[model samples]
Target chain A: MTDPKKTVSVKPDADQALKARNGRNIALALGLVAFVALVFVVTLVRLGANVGNRF
Target chain B: MAKPAVLSPDTPADTVRAARWQDYFQLLKPRVMSLVVFTAATGLVAARTHIHPLLGAVAVLCIAVGAGASGALNMWYDADIDAKMRRTRGRPVPAGLVEGSEAATLGVVLSLLSVLLMGMAINWLAAGLLAFTIVFYAVVYTMWLKRWTAQNIVIGGLAGALPPAIGWAAAAGDAPLNAWLMVLIIFLWTPPHFWALSLYISTDYAKAGVPMLPVVKGAKETRKQILLYSLVFIPVCLAPAATGLGGPLYLAVSALGGLVFLTLAWRVFRSDAGDAADPRVADRALYDVAEAPAAEAAPAVEGKRPPPVGGAKDARNLFAFSILYLFALFAALLAEAMIGIRALELPL
Candidate 1:
């Protein structure tokens, strides 16, 4: 049986664990975003899509 | 100020001051501020107004500072709802690094200072816009619309989209219809961009007692609205191409980007909203600030968590792409501006 006080208290590593997870999650998400952006840019370049030059 | 001998007078106060400074900065949401600055800079440059570079820089600074001030004030006021949301639980106010009252005071002071300086240094039109943006964000969006309606981000996007136009007006002395058209595009884009996120994080918003569209209308209704907004956004996004501001490059990218955006919106629209399927996937992929493994705790969140707190699978991905979408859209605008600059330099 755990002590009630101890049970309710958050572990010291809880914050650290949460932080690690957050960092990894953000990295993974950013990677996918970068990939999508890369694909979009490459596709535009390959197609000679000059959206930027028309104005 | 009397130095209290009892409160460790011998210890250098610089460390304490630095700690306090970091906390104050965090309250302003610096990451969001960076995006505001980039978009505003794009707006200013896109206007192609020939102002001294130094003055242009100053105008941009004022806009960024004003934006920061508004963010701080918002954090101060929304601390309650913020504390309840898992995504916001680690914000400076919720984390207890800064007192709510102090954050409010900093916000108000900075808001006043930023606006006054901008009016003096920049044109009143830009200054006026800056002033209104602060009020719209801090008073209208944060205090009222955020609580009263699901259409909050939709209407509230105007404030976020204003910085670039304000920056442009500061340089050009008047924001042209083109600048305003850019603003309109962002305004229309806000709903689909945000609602896709809301569809997944409906529970967190619900838990916080903020009656987001999904909470009041349910998942199917929210999904439908997301599609409706996307349909509206696609046509509006193309409007810039016909204007003096956009060209072939702008048109092509807008078309392609719009297609992708529409496809995602369609997927979200067609997905099952029934009880078994994890509806929170979009939000989980988008705003995964804490990044906990979705499969592990996601089921728990979906099943036991009330309608308001459950996060959908892939929500983090959706949240993330929303950021990218905004970035890409503005980058295209900057590219158009560059093209215009080159054209202006052409000798007949």
Candidate 2:
């Protein structure tokens, strides 16, 4: 049986890997935010053109 | 020398950690959101008026985001109970992949953004309905009804059933009779669909202190309720054809699908009752294992259960068929709408 109280320490290499993974995740989130903003801007421009045409 | 801190598998790390992108995505409940998007799109297409494709796409995106927002909020609030249940323990908040506070903040931000963007792009009516759907799922169902009563799914299904109407409103700027009929069909379908799942996983609800029908009222009564709801769902599904929203193909699909669903539900009811009547059978062993005291029987690890037979098989069959029934019915309606087929009149 394993000891319940033992602290499992991450190796330095493993810790570096985890940090790198997290950094990639942050970058992906930022990219998604940019895409959503682009969609919003395009939608606004199209709607504005439609309104202008109607008038 | 100071002893290192003891940590259980369930415990979060002491250090603050950046959430992985997958962790945030898991909070959105992507599977549920996919179903929401599909049903909403079907409703939009089935509407009488033609909407600009761009606006239609935006409306669908807004509804999807609103649904995801509700799912994230539900995960945040139910993290405690989710951690206790085997099926949900791997969820982001429960698994310590993401903080509950972070999930809650994401949910709130998404909810506001979706509703506001929808109102600006489409009409306020659809936006309002989307907002209400989020609140109903997050607050009414997750916070209130889930723990309070066994009738939770029966009432709380309204939120899930409203997306079609929201889609119709977005396209036509008003909900008509057909939209309401779609809502009614989904509302009636939810109890049986969810109850079938609950019958097999009642122990999870019991462990989590959730008042699912199977746990609160016992398996026999829950099975009977499943049958009763399926009986009601069949007619409601067929009603769309009568209102001219569906055509011959839609009517045929509903009839065949309803028959299959009802048969499976009946089999489940009989199997459950059979197990209850005789506890010595191997089928009863599985049921007993689920409800047995945690001390007596070790917690059955997820995905490790033996191949289900008898009542377990029946419940799983009904659950699977229920999803197909809804999909077939909606797909038929969508096809008829896109093709411009008129409803075929039957000889009285």
Best by TM-score: 2
DockQ: which candidate is best? Answer: 2
Q: Which stretches of candidate 2 lie over 4 Å from their true place?
A: A1-55, B1-18, B273-309, B344-348
Docking class of 1: incorrect
lDDT of each: 0.71, 0.80
Question: How does candidate 2 score on lDDT?
Answer: 0.80
Per-residue accuracy of model 1 over B237-256 as CA lDDT, tens digit each: 77776666766666677788
Residue ranges of candidate 1 with Cα displaced over 4 Å: A1-55, B1-19, B273-286, B289-319, B339-348
Tens digits of per-residue lDDT, candidate 2, B94-123, equal 666577887899899999989998998788
The residue-level lDDT of candidate 2 at B65 comes to 90
**Best candidate, lDDT:** 2
- Model 2 DockQ class: acceptable
B181, model 1: CA deviation in Å? Answer: 0.7
